[model samples]
Target: MTTKTRAAEIDALLKELYPRAEIALRFESDFQLLVAVILSAQTTDVSVNKVTPVLFDRFPDARALAGADPAEVEEIVHPTGFFRNKTKNIIGAAQRIVAEYDGRVPDTMEDLLTLPGVARKTANIVLYNAFGKAEGIAVDTHVFRLAHRLGYSSEKDANKVERDLMALFPREEWGALTYRLIEHGRAICDAKRPICGQCALADLCPSAFTVNGWREQA
Candidate 1:
């Protein structure tokens, strides 16, 4: 099938499978989301969720987090792994928000990336979920795998994959599309053993049902 046809099929399947996809990380405000997204790097959302409640309780807002001791923050987030670095990024991000953005998380991609540990993935999540802006695709591991499997993009690097996805999909769909792909990846198209037979997008997935499909299979 052509790329356009495959893209259309994948989009339709995603809408059907996850019509109301959303950010899995639990948070109340933009500031909270910004911190959660930062902590979420190289960590599971489940682990991040477990840590954030305690962390947020101790340091509820930007000002509170900004004033927090790095060691204490690290202790609280230890279970998430890379606690020291996560703490540094969280505190540094909060401090920047307080100092420059007046304690408000910036809604734009350019401004969001100014904070430490805020890469394109984190920025995309914050901008799309927190600010309702669709500046780019959030190409997490799930997105990276699914996009290639479904023949939406041929790029191996996340940044290139994100760029290709942003170019292929409509701007309005970009925000929710990544979330849906993530959900699908977790539930069906897993990295080790994707349930391709049960996958809604199997028909369009070029990598479906193959041993070495979409990168080396475990």
Candidate 2:
């Protein structure tokens, strides 16, 4: 079958497997969501969630965080790893939001990109989840690996992989596709050890049960 046809099949199966897939990050507002997504870099949602409660309580919004002392922020977010850089990025982003957008998180991809530490990946998630926009796909590690394993893309770089995926999948499915692939990755398509036996896309996946597919069992 063609790439588009195969991609559609993969997406359909993923929807069946993860019928209620949504952003795992817990946040009550757009600014909170944006902060959570930024902290989520190089960290798991669980870890981000653990720290966000205290962080949000202390610095609840863009205006609040924009003036937050880095030292205090660092103490709260230290558990998420890269505490120093994450602290700086998030603070810088909040400052920009406050200074430019008047304390509101901008919805446009272009405007989001202008914020510190806000890349295409972060911008894509914020746009999709917070504002319900679909400017592009968010190609996280899971999406990158799954794209290659499923023969959707051969690009090594994330931006290139995202471009390839954008071409293959429908725009409407772009946002949810990231989370679905991530769910499948965590559930059965692990990086070091994949459980191909339980994988729904095993038959169609080019890398299924291949050299990189199996993990040593205990």
For model 2, what is the C-alpha lDDT against the true structure? 0.90
Candidate 2 segments exceeding 4 Å error? 209-218
Estimate the overall C-alpha local distance difference test score of candidate 1.
Answer: 0.88
lDDT of 2 at 95: 92
> So what's the TM-score on candidate 2?
0.95
Query: Measured by C-alpha RMSD in angstroms, how accurate is candidate 2?
Result: 2.5
Score residue 8 of candidate 1 by CA lDDT.
Answer: 74
Residue 143 lDDT in candidate 1:
92
lDDT of each: 0.88, 0.90
Q: Which lDDT tens digits does candidate 2 get at residues 1-218?
A: 89899889888999999988878999989999999988999889999999999999999999999999999999999999999999999999999998999999999998999998889999999999999999999988888888898998898899999999999988889989999999998898888878886778877777775745343221
